[model samples]
Target: MSIVVPVYQGERTLRALIDEILPLTSRTYSPSGRPLVVEEVLLVFDHGPDGSADVIRELVSDHSFVRGVWLSRNFGQHPATLAGMASSGGEWIVTMDEDGQHDPADIGGLLDTALDRQSSVVYAKPTNAAPHGLWRNAASRGSKWLIATAMGADSTVSYQSYRLVLGEVGRSVAAYAGSEAYLDVALGWIAGEVTTSPVELREEHGRRSGYNVRTLLSHFWRMVLSSGTKGLRLVSFIGVAFAILGLVLVLWVLASYLLFDVGTEVQGWASTMVILLFGFGATLFSLGVVAEYVGVNVKTAMGKPPYLIVADPADGPLGRTATRPEPPEHTTPT
Candidate 1:
């Protein structure tokens, strides 16, 4: 089994997180009574100004299973995580936060659930998930709700990356390259037997998350846009429903003029103005949704990579590192 952690400015607790994980390696049986031999720990160090890259390099000198992949720059958490998973070699892959919030002790439970339930993905749902400020919590839940509305309730299982994935399944997810990849939604597509278990979450030791409100909002938009056809379908339904209603209202107005002469004889232009504004606003919003889909296709056609591989060195704890692919000379088509 391998634990894939994407490290970014985690100078505070990287070492401690590794120590907590080492105990999982010593365990003989997984939560499901299967023999366990931790294969590796694939840590992708996202580009940061801090000494995190140096720390990862130092750790690689001694550990064979602790592998590191450095990006040229910060490509956001979802992209960095995809890069790490692409490089993992374990029969089972587990992705989690580098911050100490995701408890390593829960790894056993996740593994056990995966085997017993015969699930491709067993998630560590943070029942006691650590609380950020109240507003943060609300925003997080709001994000989840948005995803659930677009995807299905099944897809919004409230599972963070602190979950176990079958090796093949993980690779399948990594194969899904998108400019706006949402980790949770991608997992929902490939993972069957998706079950959630309670796990304890923790508070960060030193630094607050590098992700700001803008970043989170950006991520949310990408998630909704690139997730799948679900959002599009919802938007389409809404558009059609509005069109039908508008047509009905027009018909009613005409009928009133021809037959009873009610709403048509109303005093002023208030009703007409309200109708015009509502129609215009709804049309613009729906058009914006359609434009997002077009933008995704444009990016894919231009051959733009969802993320870049900056500085991946060979030889580390996870085994000898493999080289990342070089990007094409031209990022976009002329």
Candidate 2:
């Protein structure tokens, strides 16, 4: 087993989190009753304003099984996670937050569930309400619902940070992920089966959430965009509906003019303007959708890699000296 965590400002909680996780590396057993030893813990640091880099260096020096990967800079949560996945070499890979909210003890349960159900991925679903204010929780649910509806996924999937994925599947998804890839959505695309296990979510030890309202909204928008082209299909449906309505309106106008001798002059300019404005708005909306799809295609054609690792554990104690080979330069399409 390999445990991967994306560390941001986790200086205070990392020690405790590692201590809890290290013990599980020895005591846990697999489904076949063999001792399940965690081969290594890959901590990928997403450059943040904290001393976590030093902390990780110290931890790596003391523990043999602990390895570190340092990114060139902060690459958001999902990208950092992909970096960790790329570095992991184990039969199963477990990912969790650095805030210490995910209990290390739940690893056994998650593993058992995954093995029993033969699932490629298992998410740790919160058994109780999340540790947040009512309004915040409601907004979180609403965002998740929007993503689910847009992606045509089951809303009950309950995507979360704490998850267990088969090693091969995780690496494959990370390798092929594009610049705008959302981890969960990518997993859904490649995973053979996905399920969830009930777990209690603990509150953060001493810090508030890393995300605020504005960041959360941006995150939600990115998730919708990364899921797929379903949003464009939705716009196409709306355009069709508007076209049908416009046809009906034209028929009504023609029938009124022929049967009752009512013409455009009797209907007045206000009604005419309303119909014209609606048509104009719908046309502009469709164009905007098309533009978005074109932008995505251009980025893909330019060969945008999802994540880059500037440092790895094989380098030395700090793992800050290693570097990945440069990716091929972007080439213009014919």
For model 1, residues 1-334, the per-residue Cα lDDT tens digits are: 8888888877777888888777676656756576787778877888776778777887777577788877667887888888888888889988888878887777778888877788898778786645577787788888788777656656537757688889988877887767566776778777778887778888876778877889878877877876777777877887898889889988987787789846534553887789788878887888888888888888888877767775554334444556778887876767
- By how many angstroms RMSD does model 1 differ from the true structure? 9.5
State the weakest 10-residue window (summed lDDT) of model 2.
311-320
Which candidate number maximizes TM-score?
2
TM-score of 1: 0.84
Candidate number achieving the greatest lDDT relative to the actual structure: 2
lDDT of 1 at 8: 83
Q: Residue 56 error for model 2, in Å?
A: 1.5
